[model samples]
Target chain A: MATTIIETGGLTRSYGDICALKPLDLQVPEGEWLSVMGHSGSGKSTLMNLVGGLDRPSAGSLMVGGEDLLALSEDGLARFRREFVGIIFQQHHLVPYLTAVENVMLAQYFHSVPDEAEARSALERVGLGHRLKNRPGELSGGEQQRVCIARAIINSPKLLLGDEPTGNLDHKSTVMIMELLKELRAEERFTVVMVTHNQEVAAWGDRTIYLDDGVLVREERTNS
Target chain B: MLFRILKNSFLKRPKAVLLIFLSITMGAAVATAFLGISGEISHKMALELRSYGANILLEPSAVEGGFLREEDLPKIKTVFWKYNITGFTPYLFSIAEFSAGGKKERGVVSGTWFAKQLEVPGEDSSIQGIKGIAPWWEVQGRWPEDAAEAIIGAALAKRLNVVAGGDVTTIVRGRSQQFRIVGVVTTGGYEEEQLFAPLVTVQSLLQLPGKVSRVLVSALTVPMDDFGKKDPATMSKDEYEKWYCTAYVTSVAKNVEEVMAGSRAKPIWQIASAEGALLKKLNSVMLLLTVLALGASATAVSTSLMASMAERSPEIALMKAVGADRFQISAIFVGETLLISMAGGVVGYLLGDQLAEVISRTVFSSTIVSPLWLFPTAIISALSVAIAGSVVPLRRALLIEPVRVLKG
Candidate 1:
């Protein structure tokens, strides 16, 4: 078995009188695809946010790649974010002003000194080599999603996070995105955690965890 | 890389950056202009005071029942602090009427004690003498040394229609004397209306020997402060002694009064106060302009960054989601700002120098040359603007919760 890349024990988060997450414990082995599924208002997104260092948990012992996430300062977590994690959003958050290649290069720029050749190759891997100079608004929805995927993988992060990456996609684009994600994961061997409401989307992962009302209700594993 | 980001950002958003740059340049230019003008005022005031010819003056002292003898002048040169005494010129004046071509001009016939009549040894006889009497006095001809020779002020000569080498009849105290005018002196004031002749000639013509109403002694002295300006009669004993000892204007005036006979002396204090007040106001105005400029620049910067940050929220959110630490996130933004500010400072400094020169010339009719220090000052000021203006928007960028952003 590969190393346990993500572990959370007794994680909790609250919003005034409401609890967003409640005493959650989970472990994610390296290079595994774990999908979190639930209806709206479930804690899946909050758990994904905590694991991504986007939001701090109210109470938890959380570790990513063996570093204690709760002990790290805000800036320390930013370093971990920039160098160790890649996230793909459902809206495909490519800077509208930048070309597809430039958007991909921005990741490398923030993570390290930018390398154009590396960015180009990453775009090529995501089937975006032909559209490198197209701006986000100029591209199709599928192409924009592909550009986002290229940007995410450009920095070669240890974990790849997807939050409803196919939610806004057509069926063909969804299949293409899912296939591309699987291929990239197999090639790069990065831990994957995706949050989705679509059961078809959740089925692409190695395991599925169902959450409701900020509690884990079910966990299931499937072999390909 | 940070610079590249800043450059590109500025290129993408020229109007905003230019606004900040202009405001900063305005601040620096005003500071340079006002400081430069203040310095010029102080210099001009000093030159005007120097027109008094000497910082010290001496004269006859009739102390109730005592009279200081003319022999006391030698003692002036031998005072305990005599080395501080540079040089002195003594004058003797007698009222006389001068007639040239039947134009009678009544003016004081003043004579100076020089080595050779009005001529001094070693210095050009042509350049020294009554020309030296008021060194600040500009003269057009040589000083007269021969019998019946005189140097007349330009204003007096103008009134008498006299010139150098021209014969003028001088009548002094019921005595008629004919003298040759050899020089014209211009002292910028009343001195320009006086007739200047040899001391011996004036003495013999007036029949008054061994008497000079006053002596002017020029000496370097420090500017007077509040303590130095206080009246000795109202001062404490220690304050009085200290005021009487320092080489201040009041102290030097007292020293000259003590050494001379039958005269009182005063400092050119009005000139000093005028210069000081102008400088104080000018410096304060410069400071106020600097603050206003920096403030305007900071606002310009904040507005630009705020606009750009709105456009870059998704990018910031993406970075946060990818696990970038706050330091890493801020480094990219702050480093880019610093780079742009430094570039702006360099350009602003150069622009500000030319701006200062133009402002001084147009507003004050004087040339202004910016000193070398303003370059760093501009750069530091721009950097401060970047830092100050960034706090709000950077906080906004950091607050973009990637989880919520990604939920879309």
Candidate 2:
């Protein structure tokens, strides 16, 4: 029996009168790759944000790593996010002024003391070793996404959240980024929660759940 | 990491940093210049007030040509309040016809000590002369050293066509004495029309032995207050004793009067009181302007920083998302501002020093030496401006919601 890393009981988030995520119960065991598939405005990103501690849910309980996230203050949530969950955005948000190495070091800095050697090795693991000094603008779409991956995992977070991490990439770059994430997960043994609309991307995960109109409609287990 | 981030950010936005730097620099510069000059002005004014020709004028108490005995001069140094007196010079005046190179002018021939050394029993010997009391008088040549030597006034020198090396014949009544003009003095007052010579030489020339018509005394004195203004004749014994002990101009004049026989001493109230009032007003004005200037620059720094913070919201948000706490974020921004302010302060101090020199030269017709304490003052004030300007902006930076900012 595996321990549940993330457990949500009737976790719901709403903006004004429009409910983004209805009261839904969800669970992910440790080291499981959980994929969320949804159309636009289908509450996939909302679930990812809440689980990553980026935003607060309108109602219900959210527990990550056996700690109640709902009870944590804003600063506490920030610490939770940095220590437990790493987020990769579709836009690959890197501080534009900082180089790839510095971006990686930023996560390590917030977690504890920044170790340049660790940050450099993390970038090397993401296949960005040669481009450590290059800023985000100097890298290609795939390279920039790789830099984001490097920064996200620099602190060795226990959970990784990717909201369309490869949405802006070409098929070749998308496959490369997916393979890289798969390799990193295999080595790090961290649970992954990814939100995507693509069936092929969802197929990379061990399990997939479909959300529609702020409700979970279907679920499937992928053969990995 | 914080310093690295701030360094990169500042480098990336040179224009914004420069804007803040310029405002802080200007504020610090103005503060330094105003404060430096104000301090120097007050010091100079005190000296000028003390040197205002003479604060006390002594004349023979008897009517007409009655003179005080010259032997009583040393008694001025042995008075009850003698230490307060800086210098005193005696003068004896007589009308004479001055003729040189066929040019003639009738002028008052004033006899005065040039740099006479006097010794009083039980006191250190001191130099008491016109050189100490009348520092404003511009003399082109040396003082007279012999009975045949004299210093002609600028006006008399011009009228008689006499130069410093030339000889002037002084005719008193039916008697005539030829004297070498050792110096031509320009006093910019009635002294410019009179001739000046050694007191002993003039006494012999006029045949009045050991007599001084008047004396001018310069003394360091406190500004007069209500008690100091009270009439000495009406004060009680204790009040009079207290008044006499204080080094007010009135009290010093009274002290000199007591020591000099058959002489009346009067304080030159016009110069003393006017100098005090003018210095007080000028210092207040400088302080007011310094405050206004600092306030204005602080506002400028605030405005510029606020604008920059708005432009850098996304950067700030990203930092927060990366798990930077409020203290970490504030440290980055405040540390940057403090560093910039320190740089501005040093630059401002150098600039303000030159500015003060220029201002003093142009306005006061003199130069000023900047005091050493002003450097720290400039830096501290610059730090204050930076901190004051960044308070609202840092609070705003802390309140920035990373979720909303990172959404776009």
Candidate 3:
């Protein structure tokens, strides 16, 4: 009986002559972990970007948490992204000059006011307490990804999007990251939409959707 | 948060920040140096112009052998524009036969004040004479200080075969006077063919007491524009009044003429016009240089910022992806630039002050004190350049899309 937090009717995106995403109708319930699987250039990342308010749709309605994103201005979308959504990138795009704790505080700064203690606590929760002062260049790939996770969750977003969050990590680090995301989701009760190419990563989601050539081809549910 | 970001950004990109900072500093320094010295140059040039000779010439209105009243000479210091009259000296001329060192020569005897101090009623006593107006005069020995002493011009002295510490006797009509030659003056003019003696002594010999042939007045005046060049006779009452009130050379000459009765006053256009034209050109050149320097600095800053923006696009995209609105992004960039500009302003002010001093010493052979307002002027100019340079880069940064930038 969970209410739908994300509802898209005929949502579409295009770049000049190239159509990145076609008209599609879909709904995601509150607190559901949705995984998207596709080959390169299949528009899985485009859907994530649209849902996170990072990209605008070419046509159709996109409603997330009762707000029609198509009606909002550019700054309004930015506000929505800061208050309602958190995103984890594949490259772990932390400001290279700032330390791990400072990176987490950067999110807090853009959302509202930055609190150093809260940023430190977030980093400690991600098992990077001892490396709070280390810059991204000095940190390992797993530690840097952990800092990225700390920055993502610092603002307490209602929805989280990940575009191959662990694509550069080894198998052990990927397993650790997936487990950490699952535990955080259980406690925080936020919706997650993650895009991945590996089936093992897709298996961690509650439901998996497959995309081919910008079209939704199939869907599968995991009885978790 | 803004301060933290600015601090970190500057610390992280030293080379880029330094480049922009240097551009702003150079622009501000050039502006400050030019502005600081421009005002002083006009005044200095005016003083140098004054050394060429008096700008106002006062002569008798009568064409046939009339003389200006020597008694009225002190009234030249009591005119409406009294303070503007820097100095004035009266001259009385007579043909006399002079004999010195056993040689006799026919020459002109000129009577004038070398450094005569005058006391006008209800006014401060002032030294008014050739020493003040003709600062470029080169005398071999000394100015005549006694009624019986005289200074012979170089040409006249050569003809008379006289040197300093010699005696000259003047025979005028039937009267005779003896003068001790105290100095030999070389003016490279008609004055070099004359013998200069104390006014009272020459007056006594000529038997024309308290009569002067002419007066030369040196006064400070503003540059003459088209309006100032208009004739007072053609102007309306109000326009004439405004022209009279202004400190143009013509107006100052008219002020002196009003005080000296039966005398005609005219601006020596050779000096006055030349001074005005030179001052105007110098000011125009300074203005042009200031504009060019500021424009060049702004371009340098823009180029530097454009390069840095390209290098930092990914960071800006990441900030936008983390939910930084345009306002927040602008705040960070603007805050960083303003901080750099302020620092540049302070440093540039110091550098420009030195530059102004060096220029003043080199060009004018004098020193100058920079005005207090120049500090704030430098800072404001620096800020203006920074803001102007950052406009394009900031627009580019705002137009960035996180989806395309963060895509791997």
Index of the highest-DockQ prediction: 3
On residues B148-249, what C-alpha lDDT tens digit does candidate 2 reach at each position? 888888988998888899998888887778889999999888998888888987888888889999999887676677898999999999999999999878
The sequence of per-residue lDDT tens digits that candidate 3 reaches over residues B1-408 is: 667778889999999999999999999999999999999988887877788899999999986368999888989988889988889899999988998778999999989999998999999999988889998879999998999998988999999889999999999997889999899999888888898988888888898898899999998888899999999899999998999999999999998999888999999999899888988998999999988888888889889989998899999999999999999999988888899999988898899989999999999888999999999999998998899888988999899998888998
Please tell me how candidate 3 rates in CAPRI terms. medium
Residue B370's lDDT within candidate 3 is: 94
Candidate 1 CAPRI category: acceptable
Residue-level lDDT for B390 in candidate 2? 93
> Cα lDDT of model 1 overall?
0.74
Off by over 4 Å in 2: A14-19, B47-277
Question: In candidate 1, what are the lDDT values of residues B318-369, reduced to their tens digit?
Answer: 7676555577678878876776677666776667667767766776577865
Pairs that clash in candidate 2: none
After superposing candidate 3 on the true structure, give the runs of residues whose Cα lies further than 4 Å from its correct spot.
B59-68, B75-85, B93-111, B114-198, B201-207, B225-266
Candidate achieving the largest TM-score: 3
Model 1, runs deviating above 4 Å: A1-3, A222-224, B1-4, B45-274, B363-407
- TM-score for all predictions? 0.70, 0.72, 0.84
lDDT value for model 3: 0.91
lDDT of 2 by residue, A22-66 (tens): 999999999999999999999998898899888899999999998
Candidate 2 chain B — worst ten consecutive residues by lDDT sum?
B43-52
